[model samples]
Target: MINPHKQQIIKPKKAVIKWLLDSDPAIRWQVMRDLTKEPDEFIVAERKRVATEGWVAQLLALQDADGKWGGVIFPAKWASTFYALLLLRDMGLEPTSEQARKAVSLVRHKVTWGQEHGNSPFFEGEVEPCINGRVLALGAYFGGASDQLVDRLLSEQLEDGGWNCEAPPSRRSSFNTTICVLDGLLAYENAKGACTAVTDARLRGQEYLLVRGMFRRLSTGEVIDRSWLRFSFPPTWHYDVLRGLDYLRSARVEPDEQVIEAVDLVAKKQHQNGRWPLQNPHLDQVNFAMEGPAATASRWNTLRALRVLDWYYR
Candidate 1:
């Protein structure tokens, strides 16, 4: 029997659907598959456009000869190879495509973690759980991640049901670090099938967020961080309400009462014109500006917000 909550359909507002359909292939394909539910062939054809056109193409064209973007392999700056790959993953670049294969190969052969760690492989990951979590996601999707990488993440799970980049020093888990790891684990499951350990770890990480209503402090019932309420694209390593809720939506966890406040917050952000605005993003040296500074209507946020609503309020 179909699970009603899991399968509920929320037809987007007609104007919103039309607006989303008129954007980049990266956004348009997802709109069709997730929002409009277009025929499979239509969805497949649209998804293919991402490899050779739009932002994927723009970012791929920026790749340096050394398989890095913005002249570095990985760095604190947002324009580096790490972020470019993260953005491409979010854009839904077809993993099987020849174009994607070539772009990823460059990084596979050239990118490394630098001399500090004796030049660790890109997919093998670095010390920080936040960075390793993202590497696991990218590796699982574009190619595959090593078992050591996966097991390392699983072992890092905090007693509180999440992970913290500052675990030994700070026993508490962090929203940002936890979200990154959860996303990686989900992608790993999707790519290589699940394990009991992975599933259990994921559930615990999710509960950590759910118990806090995804935004407020568990103890004081006060907002944990106001920045979490705002939405952004390429979210980098930050965790916002929309990004966190969208992760829950992708995992298809049953919409529970715990998520009500966060879901409502997302709904209230939609403008009367059936759109959502991009909020102030973490400023970084990005290769290019995808949209105007906060307050502009954001196609990425609108698509994600609408699909999240579809998953939640059924």
Candidate 2:
């Protein structure tokens, strides 16, 4: 009773695997769990190293007296302490780590999404979808079930199957906002294990990305925006073709013919030396380096693009 038409997924190149293994321990642990289906001795050793000497340690060392690492609660609302913790979760920081625990407590006690304080267990008020999404990501990363932010995120999803931070006030969906919401939703689903609404939201969001061919209008076939084509580091939450497609590939969703054009666009960027460039970086202050912002082919961008293309070609 088995169907045999399904194509086998492409395994990452040996060099890629080695590169991942040789990267930071936190990244290595994530690649081992997300990209590799099996955990052997090598993976176990890498995870242990992550526990002992990863960015989590560096971040933990910076925590302030009030349990907030960045000296303020929800500092800027977009890319603040709340946002950083969300990204750290996606980076595969252990939820039980003291750093993560402190962040969770700080946000829970000191932040409010809306006007009322103590009105709801989740941040109260006119919550932005992307903000809710980030909080959902934090809760899910820490294995905190019964966190209702997941429901709030879904409620704010725009009609185009994406999200917009300005949607509540302006009622307009935006490419950048949609992408951040998608990333947060993916992290949430990965942590929750099973959720039908989350699954549907993710698929619809993917379709939105695909409908635009990752960076173009379906009707005009014109680039969506100059910014859409540019790649960036720390992403700081933006929608670029590279970031969006990278998400699709990580989710292991099958790429159809529609996605090939985008895949090809990304592949063409590889230099003769077989690496991708860093292109540009989002303007923000951050603690670490995920990539280099120069003409040289960056290791981070290269690894991400190669993995996606490899999956597509297979």
Candidate 3:
């Protein structure tokens, strides 16, 4: 496994870097911190713009007075407040900003899992490992996720060292559910500081991916899902190669033989121009376009892929 430490950042093409930097504050700040290694002050200053500019502003403006987006708690259209929070987390909205505090506070007081889950508070989370995992991440990021939520998630872990929303009937873990839970669990650890149970579960979850080579069926050694090769942003609950690699990068997992194939797939996806195309764009019903339609150069996917590659190669 490769340890990602004070390793030098990889030098992406200047034009590609320019393309990335010239865009939304959400993406630009990440590029500075991860790719360009800008001074923390510059990165912080740029990150603050997310509360006032570009996609972040657009998304925030769509919010209703009720602290809900898309007018639902969790809707099939991805228009729900749940998704809005997820997207905000992905955008790296400055946690301390007034916009973030106000927005999150509204979610905390006004939203609920509805009568179905006993109208559970937003940060308290509802059933379904997939949904709770994302909720855990949002709460942790914005500072509301609870220890009770963490405890519930810990109890639901399947024997396979990962989670499955459909655990009771199938007893088999799922890649989609596993990634969502891992993201939440990791975020919880980062926000609350690691404890033995959370840390152990998180590490075991990583092993589950590593043993399967990230996107393979362990029993037959065949690609589990071809669509996993299609990269996306605001990924929702989907699991893709780039998503898997990016998670490892964020978690600071050491790169090893297990990730070589996945890393190569990301490298191969880059266009001759050095930008990666958006192979998939997870449904956004809110009318906000984070990138051009699929097959076009995508700043979000390109930025994520570049950082993941840097973590792997360095």
Candidate 4:
């Protein structure tokens, strides 16, 4: 059982949750599962709404007949087929749904990485591990073929146990790239129990982040970037402390002393009403705004932070 006092410290206030429940289905579905512990029937009903209503529905409706969004695989930053699938995955679309399957099929059969790669985008993947990581995740989550891509990504891991898009010239791994790869590997593993190589690579990648304390420089123990301290939604490919901690929780890793500082930073950001504010939104064009403009109290960030704390304190 979890410690009662610790639970109280991390639990969201009723008003905060009430506010969350009243929000879009994308946010509400996660809140129900992660925070509210709502019954399966209720959670399923709310999740089904994601396919038919609100932001998730709006995004899905934008899919072109060719099954690509914006008529391109990697179109504008946020409107491309890759990003569209990523957003859908984030929105908790039922992967097995007919519409979801069709979209995945289109990417597999119709989409290519262009003349550069001259192959199926999801299967072959692109040059950057950051992009490949996300592709691996989307492919695995949405039932596309990712075996070759997964092997390619794992083979590209740096000696430091992480990945960087700028690999050959700079062997050092990047926080942003590492988090993306971690999300991919984890998603693949959860969907299909694969080989030990995948697990080993994933753990090493995790250690890469852990060594830096999520968002710090190992050499000086200094914060890497000020923006990393700011929490955001639909993190895309960025790395922030909250994103790191939330990934750790999803991977079922226990809290460690190395993460204490980042954990403390998260706790301090909570509003008095037991909510968190959206500090930054990615500059990329999105299908639609999931939360309000920045500096407003954010249900996405609040739910993520609360869950991270819940896992840490438990």
Candidate 5:
């Protein structure tokens, strides 16, 4: 006798899986592993192609001989080494690959915070929690020694249980900054485990998001920003409810009452065909088009949303 609940949980939409599998190597690799539960051998084979083909390959090819992209770091929009490294990380590139190793090394030696604080090295990080958070993430993901930087960010957490980039020890936290820092702390802890301080800090930060229900004003229960309802890919510094839920799902967080409203907002955005449209895309320079413009069914957004819902419903 089959368990009907288990069957319902495991059943997948075949058409959606087909559409996702037909995308770039990056997207296809994630779809196979996350949604389809394909065998390890098949997923590894597809993931290997990401370094040599399509947009991921194009971005790798754009790396300069000196190891930086666009010959400068930061302030160059999406064309600099900072954005390039962030993009590569998002594409799930292998941190130990030849290109990635060299790029990480170059960033360590060549890039600096640019005279803002005696030109601190890339991994040393500057004062802002938002910037330091990104540095921690990129450094840890690419195998840089970011322990000191991680400690600094953890200390910067405010009494409110979150971080604000505008000023350290602010009475309140900014959603944008807190999310970025949370992502960084999560990456650091994943790469190098056994730090109880980091774990506690991450939980507090999660509570900060949960207390406000991810998008509402805690005091008034009003939606804080209409833009938080829109979905976007490669979000950069922006914060959205979908992005927040996706992060929570990645962190293996169990569903909580605080997340119900945000989850409903996500479900409400689904189209008749069970797809989510791209509502925003960062308008900046890049290697190539990763997804179609806004208003179209976005493979990136759809993949993220589906997996998020899968975790939520299960």
Candidate 6:
């Protein structure tokens, strides 16, 4: 029988579809490919823009002579360098572009994060889970990923079925870090179904998010963090409930009762006008405006929330 809980998921509205299509070409590409039905030509045209004038160009402009986005191996901010590249790949940036080629060359030259390299850059040679996750994603994009990197990511999976950035030092599993890893793994899984290690690691990581109701505490039943409620644009590395839920739904995970709590949380935020607001922004040198931070309705956040809600409720 069709689950009664599933009845709540709704058919996506035209406004929501248009909004998703109109937003980031990278996200649009994900939605376009995942839609139960194929989107019209208009959506395809927008995805093509990634190649024409969007992030592919933006990231290219940010590149330095060394071929990395930020001059350092891993910028002080862990998410920006590799995670940002994954965002561009998600948008459908062609790997063959000159900028992409340069970026790939730079990544290959610096670190032994993947198997193509001769030795581990560090004495331990074991990379942090998040780093391996992003490197796996980069390799997936350029068809250069090796079994070694996938093995590293799989080995790092924590007891909770998620990943933790503070592996040897902190040791506490984290929500944000787990999502970032999942994002990269899912991208790799979709691109090439060849690697079982990445596939298993991703499945467990996804279970962790779902067990927490995507945004709430498993035992306490409280919202995990205030920041989880805030929606952000270009979600650098921070994991809001909105991004987590969207990722789950996009990956076609079955929604259980645990997801209902998250669904309720997101639903309450939608305004009477059927929109969500941008609660945060990436602290970057350049960004596009979405009204202001909190006052106006954010077209991007609304599109993401509504689509996720629609899929789950149906």
Residue range 1-314, candidate 5, lDDT tens digits: 22223333345467777887888998989988888889999999898888888878899888887767888777777888878888888887878877677767877887787886788888888888887898899888888747888888887889889999875335789899999999999988888885799999999999999999999998998988999999998888899999999999989999878888888778778776757899978868765778888999998888888777778877
**TM per model?**
0.95, 0.80, 0.96, 0.94, 0.93, 0.77
Give the alpha carbon lDDT tens digit for every residue of 244-295 in model 3. 9999999999998988778777887878788889886776575577777889
What C-alpha lDDT do the candidate models reach, one value each? Answer: 0.87, 0.65, 0.87, 0.85, 0.83, 0.66
Per-residue lDDT value at 64 in model 1: 78
lDDT of 1 by residue, 26-108 (tens): 99999999888899999999999998888888988998778888887667577888998998999989988987888889889
Off by over 4 Å in 6: 1-43, 76-80, 96-103, 109-126, 169-172, 194-197, 284-291
Task: Tell me the deviation in Å of residue 276 in model 2.
Answer: 1.9
Which of candidates 3 and 4 is the stronger one according to TM-score? 3
Q: Over the stretch 225-256, how does candidate 4's per-residue lDDT look in tens digits?
A: 99999998888888999999999999999787
lDDT of 4: 0.85
The residue ranges of model 2 lying beyond 4 angstroms of the native Cα positions read 1-22, 30-38, 76-79, 97-99, 102-126, 145-147, 168-172
In model 6, which residue pairs have backbone atoms overlapping below 3 Å?
A: 8-313, 9-313, 9-314, 10-314, 26-91
Model 2 score (lDDT): 0.65
Tell me the tens digit of each residue's lDDT in model 2 across 1-314: 12111122244456656765676777776566556745577767666565457565665565555545465436553235665665566566656766556666766676554344343444332366655665565666666633466677778887878888887666656778777777767877787676898889878878888887788876798887887666765566567887888888778888787776777677667665555688767546565555555665566676676667656765
Clashes of 4: 0
Once superposed on the true structure, which residue ranges of model 4 sit more than 4 Å away at CA? 1-8
Task: Identify the candidate with maximal TM-score.
Answer: 3
Candidate 1 has its poorest 10 consecutive residues by lDDT at: 1-10
lDDT at residue 218 of model 4 (Cα atoms): 82
Q: Which stretches of candidate 5 lie over 4 Å from their true place?
A: 1-12
